[model samples]
Target: MKKLPLKIVLLFTVLFASSNLFAQDFQGKAYYVSKTTMDMDEWGGRDMSPERKKQMMERMKSFLEKEYVLTFSQVESIYKEDEKLEAPGAGRGFRMGGSMTGGPKYKNVKTKEVIQDQEFFGKQFLIKDELKTIEWKMGTETKLIGQYTAFKATATVPVDRFDWRSMRRSNSDDEKKEKKKADKDSVKSTNTDITKSDDPLSEIEVPKTIDVVAWYTPQIPVNQGPDNYWGLPGLILEVNADRTTILCTKIVLNPSDKETIEQPKKGEVVTQAEYTEIITKKMQEMREMYGGRNRGRRGH
Candidate 1:
């Protein structure tokens, strides 16, 4: 399976649905998110042994020496009607900074942030998706989502992606070589397109996904919506639960021909993919530089 596009998640809303989907009728939506999670894992810190911690601090200083900081940017496109909106508007995102856990098992890591680019708005928003919870025979229920009715459903995501990291970790060594060759070929073809710009930010590219959680009015038609969770057969009004939001905020059902709902095209500017890349590269360079300096000191 090919990697799904940030805006084309609608295809997935139905791809894995059960046979009874004909009864449902909802559309899904997507959004950009500015979420942060903390690193709670033991390996996420620079304090191990004093000597080790000291060495790590030196490495950190080198990486941060580039003055890396998280900035917001737009990624991916969303289209429910298949046409473009000047600016779809904006929403709130959750913060996930250093609140995650890392273990020695997980290689050297950093306190990082991630955002997903998907939101829902319609009649119902998915509250929880458990594994194999959709069996027609059995499932649990809960009303924790306020006055609206809610139930438990499960959806499984398969392992499939075409990103640089995914390609590098593929099991087929031949496939790996092919992918590298392909990337080199692509880079060579487009290297000239890397126009020389007076501004450093001009050369940067952004990722198109935001981690969002939306709320919906269950009274509306039910149809599994746009992106990956179309199995429910109701418009997805919210996503990520507490991470990001895309509430109706305000919706006008019908108005005169003069009425208009202009899209939004403004806000904090940054790209998660680019941000991750820059930070990772800086970290790697810092490790090398710090290690080199430490070696020189030992030799002295």
Candidate 2:
């Protein structure tokens, strides 16, 4: 038997090692920063004074900017907000009311299961359900985000009924009363195009679908991303949806230290749809309570 050349033997050994490394489970930690822009113009004709609007916008900035950490393996991932110490004497009201995005989200890419630990109005809920299906249209556009070359993908996803945008569009007492009057008068006038509806919620034309734009890198080879985004051929490095952008800032692959990726089992188990219903009912109750208080104050 003839012995192979030394260089060929060395090349074969290196190839074997590389293949083994690729075959092993890939674990990584990705750091993300999310930012959202507030639409101050949305309140342009509202009852708020300009000074009040300015103050509200300033307060909203704090809630819009946040940092998150995502721990992921090839088949499972966990996404959660990076905890930060609150500034001394910082009011919690605005932070609590501004958005419902912060939560511990766990997803299994292989099984298509998602479990989220959500907190709303001092109550905790464990949202367990299948992963949402997004029909993403892959685009040829590519951009470099940090060190990775990411390909762009777009998808149209239905807006959650309890999303911040929908909550913001909820009718105030004055608006509801005006809508009711218009609807009653519309019955008398046979103008089909009057655009008056008995349901105040119907009057608020919230966009039924939200456009999602994501930049993903095939180098990662993980079917995972921030929030509810997944199912792409590559790992999503950046996502733009619903007026907010979440971008991956750093990624550490196959770190020596490994953290457990376990689903949250603490809160009451509920589906995402059920949680939305709970939020809607709670908001209605809150509106009624506030409206009653305002009426009482005027009566005095």
Candidate 3:
């Protein structure tokens, strides 16, 4: 037989090494310290006016709950090596009259004012995330979390803290106007209004720090987790990604009734099948009471 070329021999050596790489047969819990960022750009466009930013910020705060989920997956070259895995990102959008806002009564919810398109995988989440890179590590240890034997690991993600304030008109516009008139009269009578040194928006409360901690396991290797958190060595167990938290509800390994875990892609921002009722129901009620066709009209 002719001598095998060195290059081909090296290639075979690498292949052999890869084949010999141990198949991980362990599981563990991943934990995260969760947080939330309310950004104007969560709506996709930017350069908003101060008032608009405030309004969107307030809306975002009222809309997004401070909790989310994380997932893990097993690793195999055949499954994860060549696939163009998409890192989970977050984006915001709306139902365009699909929810209560989509109904005939709230047709005037500004057409696209409500953010209905924020996906757990739509934007890269950060909290003081100046490094802009996901720091990761993986290890071996027999640990258990939610019925899975998890390995221990650690990672640090930097992020930016974001919050918002705004004024949204409600059916009580007239009442508010009367209140404002009363306030002005009181201030004029007191004459101290001219000397009052408080900022007009002193009541606005915006947080300034967001730090997150994450843990992941490769046992499930799905490259997914609760909203806007991903790209870990394994399924993240607990995440302190921001102001919100996404905890693993349950974990299963080779169950007698194994079922494919499919994430829903139809709901609006931060909304999964699990959380649809709390938010969607309230939205419907708000539309019925405040924006009813005959109730009243308000301004932004």
Candidate 4:
């Protein structure tokens, strides 16, 4: 009878070791589909003919819908857009006013660190910043996401936090003047000239705060999600923020091959606020340069 207790002790010891091994090698990959809705009226598209509006919407569709993959471990994760060939007639039209698209984003929950890759005006920038802690309000509701049950959580985040879809037009007088000048220039110039307008971001505005609703699954047992989202008790499966929605379609846990989660080291290292300021100054320089040229043309 005493030997029976010895056997029980040995069995528990084996189980404890196995659990630790699993924790050490634990990893997961999640696939997400992100979509954003743009309001045509907000961007002065209401006056356009139906054919012109259709063509514009078709071109913007590629930017509106995207797919991304998130590879995560217990403490670290990398979220990036999945590469796919551009649709027919979907030229790189969005890059005319400086590329706002960001590359892979790496986050470390344990250290509260974030590193993002950005390309602005043909220059690479590494935006390294401390992750802001999100205050999530957990709800009692639950829903099934694939095979796992997810719980609802909500939070409000400041709009200046690197969201491209949340951009709108500011109501400032300076912005109005810039818009008026651009409109006058476009009437005399080609579409290409209008696309490369000076101070393209002068009228752009982001709201004060954006509401976010996320659905997370505790079964995954990891606090991670797509884009600059982390926190909560489990892996987030879906996120709805402002005009964008990101939903996870597939999850692979502990696959045979593990991906290396490395921080992006390329580009000039700068904080989020510093990077924003840099873009602002660059846009101002472009505006001054173009304005001077226009005045000289009129003087002649």
- Candidate with top lDDT is 4
lDDT of each: 0.29, 0.75, 0.37, 0.81
In angstroms, how far off is 297's CA in candidate 3?
A: 21
Q: TM-score: which candidate is best?
A: 4
| Ten-residue stretch with the least lDDT total in model 4 | 190-199
Model 3 lDDT, residue 293, Cα: 32
- Error in Å for residue 227 of model 1: 9.6
Candidate 1 residue spans exceeding 4 A from truth: 1-144, 158-218, 222-231, 235-283
Backbone clashes, each candidate: 55, 0, 60, 0
lDDT of 2 at 127: 94
Candidates 3 and 4 compared by TM-score, better number? 4
Give one digit per residue, the lDDT tens place, for model 1 in 1-300.
898664235333333352333222222222222222222122334345667555554443321211111111111112222212322321113211112211011000011222222121111111121222121211233233433333333333332121111112122566546656654554445332221221122212223332333333333334322223333433343334222222222222222332221222232223534434444665455455654554454446
lDDT of 4 at 252: 91
Ranking by lDDT: 4, 2, 3, 1
In candidate 2, stretches whose alpha carbon ends up further than 4 angstroms from where it belongs are 1-21, 44-55, 89-101, 165-205, 294-300
Please write out the lDDT profile of model 3 over residues 66-156, one tens digit for every residue: 3221222242111011123333432134222223221000001112111122222233211111112345564444355666444444565
Residues 236-289 of candidate 2: C-alpha lDDT, one tens digit per residue:
999999788999999998889988899998888999889889888876666556
